[model samples]
Target: MIRGIRGAVTVTENHAEDMIQETKRLIETMAEKNQIAPEDIASVFISITNDLNATFPAKALRLIDGWKYVPVMCMPEIDVPGGLEKCIRVMMTVNTSLGQKDVNHIYLNDAIQLRPDLMKEE
Candidate 1:
Protein backbone atom coordinates (compact mmCIF):
# COMPACT_ATOMS: atom_id res chain seq x y z
CA MET A 1 0.00 0.00 0.00
CA ILE A 2 0.97 3.65 -0.39
CA ARG A 3 0.16 7.13 0.83
CA GLY A 4 0.63 10.70 -0.30
CA ILE A 5 2.29 13.62 1.45
CA ARG A 6 1.84 17.26 0.51
CA GLY A 7 4.45 19.95 1.08
CA ALA A 8 5.02 23.59 0.20
CA VAL A 9 8.21 25.67 -0.03
CA THR A 10 9.00 29.33 -0.56
CA VAL A 11 11.86 30.09 -2.89
CA THR A 12 14.25 32.94 -2.17
CA GLU A 13 14.98 33.50 -5.84
CA ASN A 14 13.52 32.59 -9.20
CA HIS A 15 16.77 31.01 -10.34
CA ALA A 16 16.85 27.32 -11.15
CA GLU A 17 19.53 26.86 -8.52
CA ASP A 18 17.45 28.37 -5.77
CA MET A 19 14.29 26.55 -6.71
CA ILE A 20 16.15 23.29 -6.96
CA GLN A 21 18.05 23.72 -3.73
CA GLU A 22 14.99 24.67 -1.74
CA THR A 23 12.95 21.86 -3.20
CA LYS A 24 15.73 19.44 -2.46
CA ARG A 25 15.88 20.60 1.14
CA LEU A 26 12.14 20.27 1.60
CA ILE A 27 11.91 16.82 0.09
CA GLU A 28 14.84 15.57 2.13
CA THR A 29 13.19 16.85 5.25
CA MET A 30 9.90 15.19 4.45
CA ALA A 31 11.44 11.85 3.55
CA GLU A 32 13.58 11.78 6.67
CA LYS A 33 10.69 12.57 8.98
CA ASN A 34 8.39 10.02 7.43
CA GLN A 35 11.05 7.33 7.00
CA ILE A 36 10.43 7.41 3.26
CA ALA A 37 13.30 6.28 1.09
CA PRO A 38 13.80 8.13 -2.15
CA GLU A 39 13.22 4.83 -3.95
CA ASP A 40 9.79 4.70 -2.36
CA ILE A 41 8.63 7.75 -4.26
CA ALA A 42 6.11 6.62 -6.84
CA SER A 43 5.80 10.10 -8.35
CA VAL A 44 6.08 13.76 -7.55
CA PHE A 45 4.21 16.77 -8.86
CA ILE A 46 5.29 20.30 -8.06
CA SER A 47 3.49 23.58 -8.70
CA ILE A 48 4.95 27.03 -8.37
CA THR A 49 2.96 30.15 -7.87
CA ASN A 50 2.38 32.38 -10.90
CA ASP A 51 4.87 34.94 -9.62
CA LEU A 52 7.74 32.60 -10.36
CA ASN A 53 8.56 31.87 -13.98
CA ALA A 54 12.33 31.67 -14.19
CA THR A 55 12.59 27.97 -13.57
CA PHE A 56 10.72 24.75 -12.95
CA PRO A 57 11.18 23.50 -9.42
CA ALA A 58 10.85 19.93 -10.56
CA LYS A 59 13.98 20.20 -12.68
CA ALA A 60 15.96 21.15 -9.62
CA LEU A 61 15.00 18.07 -7.64
CA ARG A 62 15.38 15.62 -10.47
CA LEU A 63 18.77 17.02 -11.34
CA ILE A 64 19.95 17.00 -7.75
CA ASP A 65 18.60 13.57 -6.87
CA GLY A 66 19.44 11.95 -10.18
CA TRP A 67 16.09 10.31 -9.98
CA LYS A 68 15.59 10.62 -13.70
CA TYR A 69 13.19 7.70 -13.78
CA VAL A 70 10.88 9.10 -11.13
CA PRO A 71 7.93 10.87 -12.69
CA VAL A 72 8.19 14.58 -11.89
CA MET A 73 6.39 17.58 -13.31
CA CYS A 74 6.12 21.24 -12.47
CA MET A 75 3.22 23.54 -13.20
CA PRO A 76 2.21 27.07 -12.29
CA GLU A 77 -0.29 27.40 -9.56
CA ILE A 78 -3.32 29.44 -10.54
CA ASP A 79 -3.52 32.79 -8.82
CA VAL A 80 -6.51 32.97 -6.57
CA PRO A 81 -7.82 35.28 -3.91
CA GLY A 82 -5.55 35.40 -0.86
CA GLY A 83 -3.18 32.89 -2.36
CA LEU A 84 0.45 32.99 -1.29
CA GLU A 85 3.01 34.10 -3.84
CA LYS A 86 6.45 32.64 -4.59
CA CYS A 87 5.34 29.34 -3.20
CA ILE A 88 6.25 25.90 -4.50
CA ARG A 89 3.84 23.14 -3.68
CA VAL A 90 4.69 19.44 -3.90
CA MET A 91 2.45 16.40 -3.82
CA MET A 92 4.35 13.12 -3.62
CA THR A 93 2.83 9.69 -3.81
CA VAL A 94 4.92 7.04 -2.16
CA ASN A 95 4.74 3.28 -2.20
CA THR A 96 5.41 2.49 1.43
CA SER A 97 4.22 0.36 4.28
CA LEU A 98 3.74 3.31 6.64
CA GLY A 99 0.25 4.01 7.91
CA GLN A 100 -1.60 7.27 7.36
CA LYS A 101 -0.94 8.50 10.86
CA ASP A 102 2.78 7.98 10.38
CA VAL A 103 3.02 10.06 7.25
CA ASN A 104 4.36 13.57 7.79
CA HIS A 105 3.25 16.41 5.58
CA ILE A 106 5.27 19.62 5.47
CA TYR A 107 4.19 23.24 5.20
CA LEU A 108 6.96 25.78 5.24
CA ASN A 109 7.35 29.57 5.38
CA ASP A 110 4.14 31.46 4.61
CA ALA A 111 2.58 28.23 3.45
CA ILE A 112 2.51 27.14 7.09
CA GLN A 113 -0.67 29.15 7.49
CA LEU A 114 -2.28 26.91 4.93
CA ARG A 115 -2.17 24.02 7.41
CA PRO A 116 -1.58 25.38 10.85
CA ASP A 117 -2.69 22.24 12.61
CA LEU A 118 -0.15 20.13 10.79
CA MET A 119 2.70 22.63 10.71
CA LYS A 120 5.65 21.81 12.95
CA GLU A 121 5.90 24.85 15.20
CA GLU A 122 9.27 25.76 16.66
Candidate 2:
Protein backbone atom coordinates (compact mmCIF):
# COMPACT_ATOMS: atom_id res chain seq x y z
CA MET A 1 0.00 0.00 0.00
CA ILE A 2 1.01 3.55 -0.59
CA ARG A 3 1.13 5.79 2.45
CA GLY A 4 1.91 9.46 2.75
CA ILE A 5 4.04 10.83 5.56
CA ARG A 6 3.98 14.53 6.27
CA GLY A 7 6.55 16.60 8.13
CA ALA A 8 7.72 20.19 8.51
CA VAL A 9 10.53 22.10 10.20
CA THR A 10 11.54 25.68 10.84
CA VAL A 11 14.92 27.07 9.85
CA THR A 12 16.84 29.71 11.78
CA GLU A 13 18.34 31.25 8.69
CA ASN A 14 18.10 31.30 4.90
CA HIS A 15 21.55 29.91 4.30
CA ALA A 16 22.08 26.73 2.29
CA GLU A 17 23.66 24.91 5.23
CA ASP A 18 20.80 25.82 7.53
CA MET A 19 18.25 24.71 4.94
CA ILE A 20 20.11 21.45 4.40
CA GLN A 21 20.41 20.73 8.11
CA GLU A 22 16.81 21.53 8.99
CA THR A 23 15.52 19.64 5.97
CA LYS A 24 17.60 16.66 6.96
CA ARG A 25 16.35 16.88 10.51
CA LEU A 26 12.73 16.89 9.43
CA ILE A 27 13.19 14.05 6.91
CA GLU A 28 15.13 11.92 9.34
CA THR A 29 12.53 12.34 12.04
CA MET A 30 9.75 11.51 9.62
CA ALA A 31 11.47 8.32 8.47
CA GLU A 32 12.31 7.30 12.04
CA LYS A 33 8.81 7.93 13.30
CA ASN A 34 7.25 5.98 10.47
CA GLN A 35 9.92 3.25 10.37
CA ILE A 36 10.32 4.00 6.68
CA ALA A 37 13.30 2.92 4.67
CA PRO A 38 14.48 5.06 1.80
CA GLU A 39 13.94 2.24 -0.67
CA ASP A 40 10.34 2.06 0.37
CA ILE A 41 9.68 5.63 -0.58
CA ALA A 42 7.80 6.12 -3.84
CA SER A 43 8.27 9.84 -4.12
CA VAL A 44 9.08 12.83 -1.98
CA PHE A 45 7.63 16.30 -2.38
CA ILE A 46 9.08 19.23 -0.47
CA SER A 47 8.00 22.83 -0.29
CA ILE A 48 9.74 25.81 1.20
CA THR A 49 8.30 29.10 2.28
CA ASN A 50 8.83 32.07 -0.04
CA ASP A 51 11.29 33.65 2.35
CA LEU A 52 13.59 30.61 2.20
CA ASN A 53 15.35 30.66 -1.15
CA ALA A 54 18.89 29.68 -0.33
CA THR A 55 18.39 26.12 -1.48
CA PHE A 56 15.89 23.51 -2.49
CA PRO A 57 14.95 21.00 0.18
CA ALA A 58 15.16 18.19 -2.39
CA LYS A 59 18.83 18.96 -2.91
CA ALA A 60 19.58 17.90 0.64
CA LEU A 61 17.79 14.60 0.16
CA ARG A 62 19.83 13.92 -2.97
CA LEU A 63 22.96 14.02 -0.86
CA ILE A 64 21.76 10.99 1.08
CA ASP A 65 23.19 7.69 -0.15
CA GLY A 66 19.95 5.79 -0.62
CA TRP A 67 17.85 8.75 -1.67
CA LYS A 68 19.59 9.21 -4.98
CA TYR A 69 17.16 6.82 -6.69
CA VAL A 70 14.05 8.25 -5.09
CA PRO A 71 12.01 10.74 -7.07
CA VAL A 72 12.09 14.04 -5.23
CA MET A 73 10.42 17.27 -6.19
CA CYS A 74 10.75 20.71 -4.67
CA MET A 75 8.47 23.70 -4.94
CA PRO A 76 7.71 26.96 -3.24
CA GLU A 77 4.91 27.02 -0.73
CA ILE A 78 1.98 29.36 -1.23
CA ASP A 79 2.56 32.77 0.23
CA VAL A 80 -0.31 32.72 2.62
CA PRO A 81 -0.93 35.72 4.83
CA GLY A 82 0.64 35.19 8.27
CA GLY A 83 2.11 31.85 7.21
CA LEU A 84 5.21 30.63 8.98
CA GLU A 85 8.52 31.77 7.50
CA LYS A 86 11.72 29.86 6.82
CA CYS A 87 9.77 26.65 6.87
CA ILE A 88 10.31 23.46 4.87
CA ARG A 89 7.51 20.95 4.51
CA VAL A 90 7.59 17.42 3.11
CA MET A 91 5.04 14.95 1.86
CA MET A 92 6.62 11.58 1.25
CA THR A 93 4.76 8.76 -0.37
CA VAL A 94 6.02 5.40 0.75
CA ASN A 95 5.18 1.84 -0.04
CA THR A 96 4.46 0.44 3.39
CA SER A 97 2.57 -2.33 5.08
CA LEU A 98 1.24 -0.03 7.76
CA GLY A 99 -2.26 1.35 7.54
CA GLN A 100 -2.88 5.04 6.94
CA LYS A 101 -3.97 5.60 10.53
CA ASP A 102 -0.73 4.11 11.76
CA VAL A 103 1.36 6.59 9.78
CA ASN A 104 3.09 9.31 11.79
CA HIS A 105 3.32 12.93 10.74
CA ILE A 106 6.08 15.06 12.21
CA TYR A 107 6.10 18.80 12.81
CA LEU A 108 9.13 20.16 14.62
CA ASN A 109 10.01 23.56 16.07
CA ASP A 110 7.67 26.34 15.05
CA ALA A 111 6.21 24.09 12.40
CA ILE A 112 4.47 22.16 15.16
CA GLN A 113 1.72 24.71 14.99
CA LEU A 114 0.99 23.54 11.46
CA ARG A 115 -0.51 20.32 12.71
CA PRO A 116 -1.32 20.53 16.38
CA ASP A 117 -3.56 17.44 16.28
CA LEU A 118 -0.75 15.30 14.93
CA MET A 119 1.73 16.53 17.51
CA LYS A 120 2.13 14.13 20.40
CA GLU A 121 2.96 15.17 23.95
CA GLU A 122 6.44 14.29 24.98
| Best model per TM-score | 2
| Candidate closest to the true structure, highest lDDT | 2
Per-residue C-alpha lDDT of model 2 across residues 3-85, encoded as one tens digit per residue: 89999999888899989988888888888888888999999999999999987778888777677788999999999999998
Candidate 2 matches the true fold with a TM-score of 0.94
- For model 2 the local lDDT of residue 28 reads 84
Give per-candidate clash totals. Answer: 0, 0
Runs off by more than 4 Å, candidate 2? none
Error of 2 at 83 (Å): 0.8
Please state the error at residue 9 of candidate 2 in Å: 0.4
